[model samples]
Target: MDLFGCMNVKGRSGTKSQSVKFFILGEEFNDDAKKVEVYKKSIDLIKHGSPRGVITPIFVTYCSRFSRMIVCYPYFDESLSDWLKRYKGGSSNLPYEIRIMIRNLLAAIEHQDINRLEDISPIVCVKSKRDNTMEVKVILLPVQSEQSSKAKWRTSFSSLLRKNMHQTWLEDKDFEAFLLMLESNEYTLENLMGHPVLQDGDSNGRLILDCFRETLTPAQHKELEEKLNVQKYDGGDWRLRLQGKTPLENMSKRSTAYPGHDFLWFARKTVAHFNENDAKFKNATVNRVPAANVIKDLYPGFISDLYKLSLEPQYLNRALG
Candidate 1:
């Protein structure tokens, strides 16, 4: 398939945008019957099965004069290949840009999964508007069967990532972890947002929430905020909050055996101290729990203190004690 830019093309209602219009020219079919059948199928699929972030051609027809199938798509700011070239050396917003690209690609794959469309090879395009916002436009084509395997999809996405990001970006630990998750097909939009590298900061030093607020709709932003309940503390750590309490507070209150005893109190203090001063503990607590041995190695003294405190009168007299 070949994409062509059309400028000043008026609509059937005699309307047109000031910007250039773009359309795709598909390879010629065997005959008019084949062309008509493909065109109708494309239209019907788009009407009933089109997924968000995937772009379907606006108009599809057999151009008798040119004897080719023309698929007219909506206007897009630029092709992904061109955009990658423009930012070849990397940019301040490169990480965020790549995030958006991956997100859209996944969305396209989700579309394919839901509709059971096989052998799809996406022609990725982008729309970077003046407001510093971007939209990814995935044009799905039946060019290859590589999409059937998660491994192949990872390879394809990694190639695209290599085009837009620098070696340093790819080498980042969080990025590597993200790629691992992608390879395992364990990634989702929510997981992507909370991925350490993305949460760290964009190239321009903007935080994840700021990036999300700029890109997501108000409702979506609100939903995410409620779901994560995460806030960046002054110490530069993103902490998850429950209700109006910090993680330590929530954990402290969760102890059934020593609810209001000195054991729970010391545990809470230990958690708070570890959260603030211990790098390993902080990293472990960011989005998940550390292994038992890891916790023991890091806080043997604290664990001992809690154990000793648990034998105290207050803890021993507790209902579950």
Candidate 2:
């Protein structure tokens, strides 16, 4: 019989490990049957989850009627083309509000180093079905070319050790750039290890090139710093400007900070990550955590407090309090 579903059975040793074989929907499979891996990637990514970003609901998981794994995604509510059509064929003299939204979206994409314009689309504006406030959203899809995804996005020591593996196709320079991204804390290394890959791994890995595309040569770094008189903004200054809205403010900060002398520290780190040798890259990567930690670190009791702090009376009270 064909396999339909399975469940994990823990061991009696009190430690959590799969020790019992799972039947397909409580039915046994033939001894010589071939098992298929379905939604292998989507399943793994759902487990690892994504980082804090301007994007949301990157993808969702579902099981099809036939009991096969399926990957589902939110529909693109509105494309850039749809918005431009409203202005009579992308002509100038666009509405001021629409212009600002477009500007902010472009800034976000640039800060994220996205290439294709289609990757971004405006999500439909809607009332918070629950709270009744206007909300805006956008989508930034990641690159998914087979060669790029396998060679540059995901890799492990075992994969690297394999002869004539997919990763072997990467050019020496591209490979070096990939390793540099991992070393610099720009890309978390934990995802490259065993178990479920990072939910945002492919996109983040793809963007690493954008982050490392140009390194600040010493002369360039010095010249920029001299121009700025070596000034800098700390968390306090950012907090005031951001007004406690960390996520929204961080995106703006990333865009304006780039190509500025005061942000040389970020640039220098990129240079350091790019120049590190393989040994150091691997060593430093060992201590890193995935991007999901960014959310948890910001709100320790997030899951438990989400509804309590977000829903009706609580949210209203806190805001008015």
Candidate 3:
């Protein structure tokens, strides 16, 4: 149940610029006062805080307030960086392995009230040291706060969808917020990138978008409400308890349907996975990657004018039509 000095620290760590983090050993937390609270919360999150079968300690703590201040978790496996490195660039293929882990982690993030989960990128999850035998255990760290919440939300959420790359079941409006953020970018798709897309970008325009994205149809929102009712706080699999109301599930069917024409816009990314590797490395792919338009599957006529605005950098002024 306890992993003593089980520390394997790596990555861009410990700096004023470094986002908030907790060490696996006594070093897990720096703030003495909040450490206890964080550890307790973490324990609650683990469902099985004892860390008996985890590959890494879910966390380290003592009943003593001092012990509670410290926490520990396994090293992050298949990090966003790892994903990019393995794929050679931006070609994120959603294999089953990544899918299960990612689904679990996003679910974890949905449950996390921590504001810091926003800044991090290329989302990842790790098995627990205590019981590699149990269901997957993931640790999502803090994201940078200084960046505009909108930008951070855009990057993180898009990165999740891009990595998962699910087809056929988007439910449209369900994930519109993840793609075209509501608080900031809804009025103009240009501002659709961060959490709460912002409350007041263009009041009238936002009012319309808010009506669409947040105001899910009664049936759609009803399922979420129903599942949330059976929440069992015993640290069991959150997916099991939430009755399928996952972070991804919040997406709803958009009342505003796009034009009927379907087109695959992307041509492959700079960073794709190695699922089709051969000879010595039989896990990499060599296929045509394609564009991920701001909106896809639009009516042919409307598709030409799909997105006049670009996100700058790699997509700068490139004709989307």
Q: What C-alpha lDDT do the candidate models reach, one value each?
A: 0.46, 0.31, 0.32
The pairs that clash in candidate 1 are: none
Query: 1-321 in candidate 2: lDDT tens per residue?
Result: 122233344558868643221112211211113122223333443454432223332232233344432223333233334443443423111233332333344345334432233232323332344775433344332222233222232232223212221232232222333333333433333322211111232233222222222454555435434432322323233224334544324443554555444233333333244335354442443223322222222222221122122223533343334
- Which candidate model has the greater TM-score, 1 or 3? 1
> Candidate 2: where is the Cα deviation over 4 Å?
1-53, 66-80, 83-91, 110-115, 118-137, 146-321
lDDT of 1 by residue, 99-124 (tens): 66566556566546322222233445
Which stretches of candidate 1 lie above 4 Å from their native place?
9-28, 32-37, 88-94, 113-125, 128-132, 142-147, 162-164, 185-194, 200-321
The model with the greater lDDT, 1 or 3, is 1
**Alpha-carbon runs more than 4 Å astray in model 3:** 1-32, 47-57, 62-70, 74-78, 89-106, 125-178, 181-321
Which should have the higher TM-score, number 2 or number 3? 3
The 10-residue segment of model 3 with minimum total lDDT is 261-270
List the candidates ranked by lDDT, beginning with the highest. Answer: 1, 3, 2
How many angstroms is residue 278 displaced in model 2 relative to the true structure, after the best TM-score fit? 67
Q: Global CA lDDT of candidate 2, please?
A: 0.31
Clashing pairs in 2: none
TM-score of 1: 0.51
